[model samples]
Target: MFNRRNFCQASVLACGAFAVASSHLANAAAVMAKVGQPLTEVAHLDWLCNAVGLTSTGRLFVGLPRWPGFENTPSIAEVLPNGTLKPFPGGDWNEWEPGKPNAKALVKINTIHIFDDDTLWAIDQGEDAGPHGINPGQKILQFDTRNGKLLRSITLAPAVLPAGANLNDLRLDSGHAYLTDSGLGAIIVVNLATGVSVRRLADHPSTKMSPERRPIGEEGRPLQMPDGSDHQVHSDPIEISPDGKWLYYQPLSGPLWRVPTEALRDTQMSEKALGDTVEFVYDTGPLTGTAIDSAGNLYLAEYDRPRITVLSPDGSLRVVAEDPKLWNPDAMIISNTRELYIPVPQSARMAANRGPGGVDGLVRPFKIYKLQLPALYGNRETVPALVGKPLA
Candidate 1:
């Protein structure tokens, strides 16, 4: 149910144990109340648990990659608050380019983001991967949820294609967007109004920390690859400043990196000049997913030791809440009321397909823990942003 391009993204994130950078909170803490039912039912998908995005009305969208030797399977699916599950009609997580609107392209959508109107923007991630694991190259498409119709596809022009680039995660500031190229290592910019895109930080060290040099594992050990070796780290999840100043990002497998959004959009400046503008934000060991709350607190899916941790606004940090139950938490969304909705995307089966040392999927069962935060679960009665969306 998960597809592997034989592309090793180093496959790990908030899937295993929990690591805390602060000793103020108890080391072995529990935040999960474990009271809710499976948030929704996914069909023909053992990979639904990977990447997740939710709309204002509580409509949940998910992405799936080809798992095992399979190439064509349902890749994208949606679930209602009431537990109804269905494919996104035209969303597909498999092929490089999304299936055309008229067919069953509904299965290949990946890397999803929901806008203010809850309009769904899904990244095709190039249904197929070329050299360096780059998919349909890098493209973004906007679809109308009111009818699952293919609205528009945002393709980066040849001027923006810098070597092997795959559009990774992104965040919006005003009407502009900042994105990461996990494949060849680059930070990208897109003007929402002009549809103009630019590729920057083509090889910035901060954006491409060779996985070899990152900190060792919790026990001071190293991450093991299928060959019993450690792969170099790369780029991933990013967030744009609400004020539109700084853009925050990190490797799906490295500490966080931040760069000036304006510096990237500047066509006049050379990449060398832009690289000089990058700043090191968090030294998070590794994460499967990253999210920044309206409060400016950053959430990371700690991969090595699975748990969702937060970087407070003041820079102080702590393990928000972690449990094996949290699983391989990938892309996540925070509701208007501060309740965190995590989409635990399964990655084990994905790893195994690459070779060994990775496990398989049992559809990566999940349970959404609705709780108040000090990073942990408290019985708070705030109206969750997604509460309006019917889960029934």
Candidate 2:
């Protein structure tokens, strides 16, 4: 019963719809292809590095952990504009021998952070050549980036640092510094002015690796310890909210957590009361390093995948960048200009992962990659109020 004109009109409408659909599909493919295209290599080093930090002025610093194979290398280095690694604060600070005094040298530097005030803070895990343990060498060092001068060195007391305590990362407020003990599952709160420290939420379920959340390596398999058991890392990643009111932290195998800064600063708060204050924030999968933007967004280094995911303030998560070369992106930092510096140390390829080739499986010239953040995060001018202020 259809007329020729009506049939022709219907065909025209169908063709128009088809064209629109095709355009949308093509646009989507372009976006997917661009996801990781912005990732650029910032530096490449022969030694393994686990952490990176950026100052407000755009200077970059990296931490070289004294791992089994990298014992003779410098513990900390500044990446020059020419892409050369120079021992930072130079001289004896980078020299640590087996029999020498550990107090004067950098031993097993785990993480480094550069504050807006242009001060660099480095955490020494204190394990010289033995299993993870507490020693007189466990310390947090503050250096003036302008002159490469040592400002303050705070040694963690054995009373606060237990036998298996592996001080992993640090975040600072105006008056205090917070650290994570990965090996023993605790938060060590240090008074910045007095150097006094107290262990908080010790063995708390929130700090401990979840019994169900087994860590997975970049190879898409559960990471195992040398004993053939599931590899476990307790509290490892930690960050302070831009406003300095909340602290976000979690185990390497995570469900992200947060607690109020006021509660953490309270020395008299009972362990049970402090534990009660910890709030479950998000169910972040296995991640290594975390950085917070002025927008209160958390940028996470996905430990099991080759991507960086940002967790918004409202609890939504999205992958901001992805690349095949982002192997085990450890600790990351967001610069004032809204660029993220990611260090891919390939910890999964290390000897502990039990790969087919042991340490030989590691790729040489460990890379530190960077990505310009999306415009949605905004730059320093947009978030000027918190740009150079004390995080807390």
Candidate 3:
């Protein structure tokens, strides 16, 4: 006796209930953890907070990407330990207008990296992909973290950023920066001194997302793109060995790979040669972010399994911690290798999970958690002397 309308309503309600049950299961798994403990929620936000950075002096910076359900607000802000948000550097940089030179301003901050030298580097993802005539909206900015003043800004060349380039996270080594382009499946390397950035390993199997792995979420549900396509999280997490000899990188769903930084720095290196140099590491199911300690240990976040894994220099892998609270763990940073900070955005509840006209599924108050560990070395301040190293 039920009509089509009633059937559809029932289906939606059933799916919602299923999602809730999955969340409960995840929480239950958290209780089974025997290694690292559940995340200590630092600050809560009503909006999507995808990126986080911590300064040695204890300043916390958060980036809010302009995604669906994002109330028109500043894209980047500094969160005091007391949990107050202040527009970073300046609010004007976040205010964008159609005809204005918005590229110079902080349009949309995809990631932020706080260095030991008190410099804050940010990747500003300009407009979404479209036939807008290739605007110079994509760039990188460095600021003096101590005073929240701008230091330098570099607008990337059009060739470096093709249509649909999501320049995700970055790692700094010596005087160079390496960035991952998730949207186009590529890597971008920038010279900190010369401000010249080059794109590398475009469409390489190592940089491309896995066709076999789908970022599953609540109730074993696969995350979906806005167009109802399966969400393919591409090359995102990146790290540099403490010695700065090798650059470790992988797609969100990984079979981790690395190549010598010596080869990576060579502007003349052919794409085929670079591909030939890539060494396959372990197969990590899916990891969104990674950081390396001074001893060359790599910490990777497996958001789907809701745990963090550590890969040693000798190729040994172990689970550092597992907890249900690690939902959609995105950007991660290690503070002096003593603490690992992870932000859980619960993206399975975001709009893209449900496609167009999708209702908001996530609860309010997003989370940032940290893990304490034995004192270790971090590479932010230890720029290895790889400037003139032999590539051979």
Candidate 4:
């Protein structure tokens, strides 16, 4: 006869097995209450959460990079209202094993954005730097937000992404997409229709990180690499204007720059001509992610001071929100509800592959927060104007 002790032990084992088998939907249901005012804690993740995006309907999507420990975790997930993370566009697209066939896998999602057309777009960084060298898996993906249906998957040309390239943030405008490669210090422009892409501003002053720049830690100290040198991230922030005419961007440490959309699409234009189109906007001291409003105002996630700054269309900078709880705000999205959603990953504190220090380890249960915007802010409830000619 089975004793009570044995029964309890077996029951516990059964529950453990169930949880492991259903890891795909783990921690997505538990609700963690708000931590602070204005900055309400949204979904909490034990893994390294990088960026968050919201659809026009207010659906939440979050991305997890394949860092050291979370190699096989879902690269992209939909955070339900109940706070559970379900693989977006579902199925085995997010599942991958080393030796198995991962042809359709979302290996590592560096950043994701929901566009005006109700489509979700992402930059899959592909491979991380293993002990050997840079792993290679970069690709661009597009999906329908309504049903998680994948619309497009375009593998980037090797010429666009060199050996050290780390595909970072992306912004969609008109019919084209602009992507920043932080590791290689360049900007890539892609024609969505034909999937043709070209690398731009490679080694251009605008794309390179400020030589003396270093991200500050939560304790108000300069972040340093293991070697004691200043830590840095290259061209990581890119945002398109509400009119789709201008593209503003800069490195992690920056003096911001802007260029006309026409200049990026003109493949035949000489390098000097393209460079001439770029204008020195302003010096954004220390920033991570950015978003733009229809009124042409740019919202910046200013990391050092830990606040959101609005760069007005007339070239004035003003603080939008300043809260002590805002630590290392990464990717930001302006929702149709006139709210800016910021995901505070505290990425710099987390430990990288080597050990603690840069990317060492921060407080767990990473959070996403939203700050309301004024009613006059241009909200993209419907699809924005798709300007410029479609690809041939």
- Kindly report which residue stretches of model 1 are placed more than 4 angstroms away from their true locations once superposed: 1-45, 67-72, 91-108, 132-134, 214-233, 349-363, 366-370, 374-392
Is candidate 2 or 3 superior in TM-score? 2
Which sections of candidate 2 miss by over 4 Å? 1-37, 128-132, 355-359, 378-392
Write the residue-wise lDDT of candidate 3 on 1-392 in tens digits: 10111111111011111211234235434443444544566788766787787766777888887766674657788897678888788766877654567755776678887766657788887766543344357778877766667877777767987766777878878788888888767888889888888898885888888777766665555678778777776788888877778887788767677877888889887888888888776666567777777788777776566667676665555565667677677777777546778887777778767655556778678888887743333443354333243111
Error of 2 at 232 (Å): 2.3
Model 2's alpha-carbon lDDT is 0.75
TM-score-best of 2 and 4:
2
Give the per-residue lDDT digits (tens) of candidate 4, residues 263-346. Answer: 878899776778767777776666888888778777878666555667776655555665655667888887877778888877
Q: How many residue-pair clashes does candidate 4 contain?
A: 8
Q: After superposition, how far is residue 380 of candidate 3 from its true place, in Å?
A: 7.4
Q: RMSD in angstroms, all models?
A: 8.7, 11.1, 10.5, 15.8
Candidate 2 residue pairs in clash (backbone atoms < 3 Å): none
Q: Rank order by TM-score, top first?
A: 2, 3, 4, 1
TM-scores for the candidates: 0.75, 0.85, 0.84, 0.82
lDDT of 1 by residue, 1-392 (tens): 11112111222222125333432123223344422222322222344445666665667776665434344545556765556566674434233233444132433344777656555676655544544443443467666666676666677865565446666676666566677776677777888778888877776676785755542332223444566555443577777654556777777567676777777778898877777777766556667677776556677766555466667555655566555556556786676555666766545334532334654443534444433454332221122222134222
Against the reference, the lDDT scores of all candidates come to 0.57, 0.75, 0.70, 0.69
Count the clashes in each prediction.
40, 0, 1, 8
- For model 4 the TM-score comes to 0.82
Best by lDDT: 2
The best candidate in terms of TM-score: 2
Q: Candidate 1: how many backbone clashes?
A: 40
> What's the lDDT of the predicted structure labeled candidate 4?
0.69
